[model samples]
Target: MMRRPGLALKLSVLLMLGVVGAMVVDFSLTSGTDMDRARVLVFVSIALAMALLAAVVLDTLIIRPLVRLSAQARRMEDRGYAEPFVPTGLDEPRELGEALEHLRQRVLAEREELQRLNAELERRVEERSLALAAAQRALVEGERLVAVGRLGAGVAHEVNNPAGVILGRAGLLLDDAATPEAAEDLRVIMRQAERIREITGALLRLGRPSRGERGAVDLAAVARSAMELARHEAVARGVTLELSCQASEVDADAAALEQVAYNLIRNAVQASQEGGVVRLHVAGSTLSVSDTGSGIAPEAIPHLFEPFFTTKKLGEGTGLGLAVAHGIVRDHGGTLTAENLPERGARFVVRLG
Candidate 1:
């Protein structure tokens, strides 16, 4: 209803001053006795009316609207997401109000989506990781079986020749005995034959063929027997068989333990050169066969228990020795590993888990 407060206030102030000056001028113009009292009263009344009008305009238009808008802004800041703001006047200020409200909604939606995606991705990664672990375990078991099969072939192949020699020689001596000294020679031949048979028997106990039955095995006794058999071989090669052994036992079938020992010893023997030492350390409910010959490469060590993976030449070996030991150990709830010695040669470590 009234003019703007700033403009009205300025006009009111100017009118008040002009009225005072006009009163002064009229009084001066009428001389000291004229006083001009009626004109002065009219000017003063006009000034008062303008001042009252200016006060009304300030309250109704500028001051009251600003106070209401300020209260709305404070309410929106305090309770942002719960409600929408009332539409105010247009311009940059109006756009700012709308943008603030929409910004809250967008932030809330993005926060929710981010949490959901993080959970989903974490779940998928865990599942994939478990599957990979299971597959890796299966692959390792299969490789172990293949290794055992190859070692079995080497033992059978090497054993057959020695058995035939002892058996043939003993049979001839038994048929041709003719004197006391000859009889003693025949006795020696007979004993040698028996020893050879015992060796094969020990091996058979540890290396069960498809046609054989696996029964309760004594692993400790079998290990001792294998150490006995390797002793002579080590001496003949000018190498000392270091038996770092203590009394130990296993519930495995006796035959399998012998083969495990045999495979380990054989690898140790091959690793060492003449006069080099091979250590047969048995403890911790486990056994280790080590030799000082040629160290294995790091790359080769990983595949040492793999079937047909031999550092030996094709003609010299079939690469099943360590593999067979690994399989047999696993069958007895154990593990087998091969590595190069720090100084020289390779070491076979077997453990029954």
Candidate 2:
């Protein structure tokens, strides 16, 4: 890159040339006088000293301040507004410096406002994205449950007949068994067939729509009846059953509500550990069943109410309990929801009004 002479350098060169021209003029004018070499030398020396002093004063008062102002402008252009800017020099230079500082302040304010707006936009977008995803998940879950209901409605009808026939044959063979062992074997067959019949019956009930009469029934009374039914199972499992009823009335099918309450109570009882407590609470239009046992598995929560989705060991649970309970609650124009307690165990809440 080619370098240009600075203000100071150019002024110094011009002053030197003027001093040499003055020396020529002086010597030419005094060439015929009695002036000697020492006097001429003294005159040249004085002129040279004055020229150097003038250069130093002009550079300090004018050139250096202008150079500093240019550097400040460059810093402003780069958005270094954190430091306060002070106008330098006098007259027009000071005014120009003040104007540059004002422009820098305005730019800084605008940039800060833009950044705040961008952050707000991002937050809103994230909230909308989360809401959209939740809605999509709900849509898919609804479609899946409807499909399962339709399939179950058909399968239950077909399975019921064979299950009944097996139950009948096993009962008949048991009555005619020659040995106790044979009778016990036939009884096992009967028990298994009976289980199949119960499952088909539950499926049929779940797939069928609610058509029962609705009336004002006491929610507390219904819950108490359910607790009584589950009392035997709780005792057998060494779990305690505690019931708290508030005598709240609600418009619902009495039989259906009783079934839901019974299912929830029975599940809670089964989930409780030995010597653990199962609590049933009925207040207003709500019924909650809580058990003091290990909390529900997180992975099983999403599919907890889906038909045939169970966390139970084989031969322990058919997994249709919660599915059927959920369907019954929906048919009653109510809701059934399950969640794990913070400390321990799980809770099932039924709301009907």
Candidate 3:
């Protein structure tokens, strides 16, 4: 690239040319007259002073201001809009500086807008990522539940026959026992057999086809029935049952829906502390049961609706309640979801249409 001469150098060259011209003119005019050497020297000195003054004026009004303005533009490119560009000097340079300053302001505004848009895009992407992950988890869970149901149905059928036989034989032995210890032993065997039968019954229920006679069933009424059934347990536990029902009807099996409501309410009652509130709200084909207990454990939430997956103490729960409820809701072409509340406790929502 060719480097151009700066304003200072160009002005200096012009001033030197003018001085030479003045000296030449003095020599030419003096050639025809008796001009003294002192007089010629004085005239040359005056020309030199005028050139110096012109140089000073140009530097102050044009050269120095243009240099400052150029430096300011470079700084603006490097450092963003942190500094203001102040216009200075004579009309032409000042106008140019003002134009550059205006450009800096516009660029700054555009840069800020671009930054805001980028931030918004990032936030939306993050949200979509989270939603996609949740959807994948739900899909896997649904497949697992289907497999569990098929297996449970087969297992329950196979186990039911032997369980009944054991109970029958134990009962006969208990009646024929000759000693108190023998009778007691037989009783224990019968009791265990009875428990086995109960377990098998629950498994069958969980695995059975949930679709039943469909009718217009008012969810509020079903919720009210469940609330009544749980009223005694709630009272015994010193838990308050709060019901807010709307006359919302859904095409579903009344008995199955009631069972779902009952199971959810029962679980909520059992989970709550004394004096804790158990809220049952039914509105517009949606029923939610919320309990003011310690929220469900995060690790246990995924398996909450899986058969035999219980958080309750051993022997206290068969763990088929939620599984059955989920199956019923699914068969009704609805969804049953459980979530921990932000403040405290857990909420189970059943949405039907």
Best by TM-score: 3
lDDT of 3 by residue, 1-353 (tens): 95343211112324322332222222433343345656655766676677667666766787778888888778766786778777888998889989988988898899999999999999999999999998898778777877888788789899999989999988888788999999999888888888878878767767774657898988999999989998999999999999998899789999888889989998998889999999999989899999999888999997898888888898778888898899888888888999999999999999995
Q: After superposition, how far is residue 226 of candidate 3 from its true place, in Å?
A: 1.7
lDDT of 1 by residue, 94-170 (tens): 55556755765676688789989999999999999998996697577556555555565558558867877877887
Winning candidate number (lDDT): 3
TM-score to true structure, per model: 0.44, 0.63, 0.73
Put down candidate 2 lDDT per residue, 235-275, tens digits, no spaces. 99999999888889899888888888888888888888899
What C-alpha lDDT do the candidate models reach, one value each? 0.65, 0.79, 0.83
The better-scoring model by lDDT among 1 and 3 is 3
Looking at model 1, residue 25 earns an lDDT score of 19
Greater lDDT among 1 and 2 belongs to 2
lDDT for model 3: 0.83
Clashing residue pairs in all predictions, respectively, total: 14, 0, 0
Runs off by more than 4 Å, candidate 3 = 1-63, 90-95, 160-198
Cα distance off (Å), candidate 1, residue 277: 1.2
